[model samples]
Target: MIVFFLAIAILITIKIIWVLCATSGQGSFDREKKEIIRRANYLTSMVCTSPQGLLDEMPSGIGEQFQGEWALYTCSMTSAALANIAILYPPNKELSIKFIDQIIDIAMSEEIREYDKLRWREDPMDGIYGNLSHISYYSHLAWMISRYKQIGGDGKYDDLYHSLCKAMNRRIRKSKSLNLPTYPGEYIYIPDMLVAIVALANYSSQYEGKYSTTVDMWVERAKKEWIDKETGLVASFLEAYNDSVQIVLPVKGSYSALNCYYLSLVDSEFAKEQYDCLMKNYKQGFPFAGLKEYHDRTCLFGMDIDAGPIIFNLSPSGTAFTIGCAASLDDMEFRNKLLKTAEIGGSTVTWFGKSHYLLANLALVGEAIVLAMRTSAPQTRMRNK
Candidate 1:
């Protein structure tokens, strides 16, 4: 049910990301896999065709308008999808190359470069990463660049990778939990931090011993921040180290599942344990297995930005995302069931000659996730050659 409400609420800040408990089977295994891939192709193509004309700018400090995270999220998402395409969907190699060109164009286009020069929000000083947004936005770029390199990307982006990781390395050192300050406060998004960790992992692959241990250290600290004390499921947000229900926000399937998506890549054993926990807690059976956005405590509340409309507490975003997790765990039983549900529920749609979801058409990130799930190991693939 990864229903991404385009332009209203960010669909998913995937990096596409998590759970359903249903064990029902409605379609053949082969049919479900084909549908999932068909949908993945549609979604990824839509991203490649997404217009890059006017930047979606939002209010910054005072009067600025380039502070929103959408564009940057799109960048991370597309690149992540490219990573999936190269590593997981080998049949689409020729097509993936074309999408790679489109993504690079988006990043290096005259419009994007000009926007960075004049309007891109940054610190007053000339320091490359003086502004937190500069660091925040570019960390994913580091992850993307690293993944792009695995697929034989030209060395043109090598410098960009170093620059983005350099700034993020500083942030990793400064933050207590290695959570880069997306807004200079404890308010942090888990996926962003996870992406930076993957970036560091990629850097370590090149340098050998430098960033590997740091990624491990950060994972240890992050477990405390992300996991719920009672349910043992991942939380949507963390206020502090304390585990009080008040401080530990309710476990929402959207964020929780999204965490598992990247977390599986960062710490698979841990991610598997939490994914199992999530299936126990957040996933519900509507006479069939589907996932709820919030746990029972917060189920009555209205939908948040991440968790879209909750139909019987079944979060489309959460349910859809968990397909990737199920795929990672090789839980084909659950994965196929969820795929059948997503299709029967009519989430996939065709519009303007493009295929996407109806609930939240900008399923760009969510759909990209569908592609990533196809891989047995969803971690970043490091190429030594």
Candidate 2:
């Protein structure tokens, strides 16, 4: 049987060579994926920025006007686009800096200020205005600025960041009911507290030594109150009654996105809890089966512009955005599954192509991929011993 043994050894040698060749070829495959992502990023950036830059028709009016809301969304879209670009392509430092300036300019423009005042009242066309109380606008602005700072936009927007943090803190304090801030009460549905938390976290990261206590207090309270113990997910709202805080029912994809944001501020344990809960209940074909398919079920059903169109039993917004965060944390299985879901969902666009789909889709996908890359990359953490 010596010949039989020799034959087996020869086959094993061939297999080893095949594996080596495959391993060596991985660089080319990675280059290809990078190129695809780069192209997608370029496409998304153009779609988000071009509409406003090229528009010759500027809307007229001051506060609570249709023109003001349009400008707000436009600026919001531009800010999101620039943030995604900055994260994805660190090499494009000049472009990112310019975009940050553009975003700030847009925010400071006469039109936004007028609209800012209208947020608390009702307008003729748009109904109630200023429901987000500058928190939403400033949160996005803070995010863009923080990203810029992370990518070397230092000392440029420090004052703006400080102003935004103070404004947000004041609003939060004013809105707090029974120690838990009630966000947007009735007129708007956007999760303002989550946005505020993310913005505060970025600010804290920037000035940790100086603002450690303040940051810690906010982060700790958010972790304790907002996070749901049973599901390990953060609820959208809290009802205040007799100095007691009660969790609001019917969690949503928007809240899922916020969970990722909140997790970024906390430690790995919090993230793991959220990940386990999402996989067990929110994902398709898990213990919470048919959630991805149900459209009318408020708790699980998806199809908002912010959430994007859920298709084939999947929450596009929830899955796509979370994948990047999961990837950054080295949750390979979740990342891979999320990437697959995005590929499947992203490929189904037929109407306005990628440009017609909401700007968040592209922005979220790009950010997720970039965050995944960052999580995988090695880094030195500066710890005070």
Candidate 3:
């Protein structure tokens, strides 16, 4: 009984600290923006690039398999990292251009060419195939086309983007199992759907009226398939082989963040629902409190570089990635909470009187804040008008 009471007290104390740190109105971290840029640039430089510009896999200390056709995962991180860098420091146009150029070169490489040639055997047949690997590739490519259009390298990239969209569409059409396009076979999972929706949406944005209907259809399908009405959180996947699309239960810590981030793009009701669900279900325990892995009955907690280190019982990687998504979505409350959590979790390391994680988080946070402020700022009228 004494131990239980002590645990309760600890939880309460942590929550209080989180609230205080998050709600502090001075925006104490804003001044650290330059450091943030430097750190992000450093990290980006380390994880990405070979002589040819293709992204290399970060060493997988966790259970993540880097050897498979899943080599595409690195590109996804590169896309998100590059997009974040562009958003934070637009002045560094040359660096951004270089990164994008590298990515394009990699996509057009013999390795990718070889993968494309053998995709039939190597790929999953269900619509849900390719999982995170494919999703990362497509999402990064789409984001580059949509968000970083100014850094256009050559007409070849435009063609590449269009070709990718056409290929995805062809895959969807071939998997005629569902009324809406499935992944490859019958797999209608959440992550795949999220990536597909974002890719389609980005492509449609480029073409405007030309692909608007297609974009809308994919978004609606995501809404109908992945979202759980009861919990308001999106499920991980819908099993293809099952008679009915089996909805996996218990929302994932990482999925919550990714779902919210993706939803911000289309501004669908599903996004709002997922956000609300995240707020409702988030517990103060785990990394902020004391656990490493976020294990529950439905989802098992494990370490993957993408999922981050699972400490105590919480997945740090998931939390960090989720924080990025939350920031991208402009959820100030969640963003603040995530920032505070990072502070407590040792995500922000101090070196020579300078904070590391805080710098990275601030850059990301600044981008989100600036985007939100700009969008919400009241319009001013010119005197002449």
Please name the candidate that would achieve the greatest lDDT relative to the true structure.
1
**Residue-level lDDT tens digits of model 3 in 131-167:** 2224434544555555455333345567657756665
Clashes by residue pair, model 1: 1-316, 1-317, 1-320, 2-316, 2-317, 4-11, 18-321, 18-322, 22-289
Candidate 1 on 211-273: residue-level lDDT in tens?
787788887876665567877865565543432222346667877777787777667898888
Arrange candidates by TM-score, descending: 1, 3, 2
lDDT-better candidate, 1 vs 2: 1
Candidate 3 regions exceeding 4 Å error are 1-32, 51-57, 60-71, 107-139, 150-154, 173-188, 241-244, 283-309, 343-385
Off by over 4 Å in 1: 1-41, 49-68, 107-135, 224-226, 240-247, 298-301, 347-355, 359-364, 374-385
Best by TM-score: 1
lDDT of all predictions, in order shown?
0.59, 0.49, 0.49
Off by over 4 Å in 2: 1-33, 36-90, 107-117, 122-132, 173-184, 187-191, 240-244, 285-302, 348-385
Residue-level error in angstroms, candidate 3, position 263? 1.6
TM-score between candidate 2 and the true structure: 0.65
lDDT of 1 at 209: 58
TM-scores for the candidates: 0.74, 0.65, 0.67
For model 3 the local lDDT of residue 161 reads 72
| Cα RMSDs, all models | 8.6, 10.9, 7.9
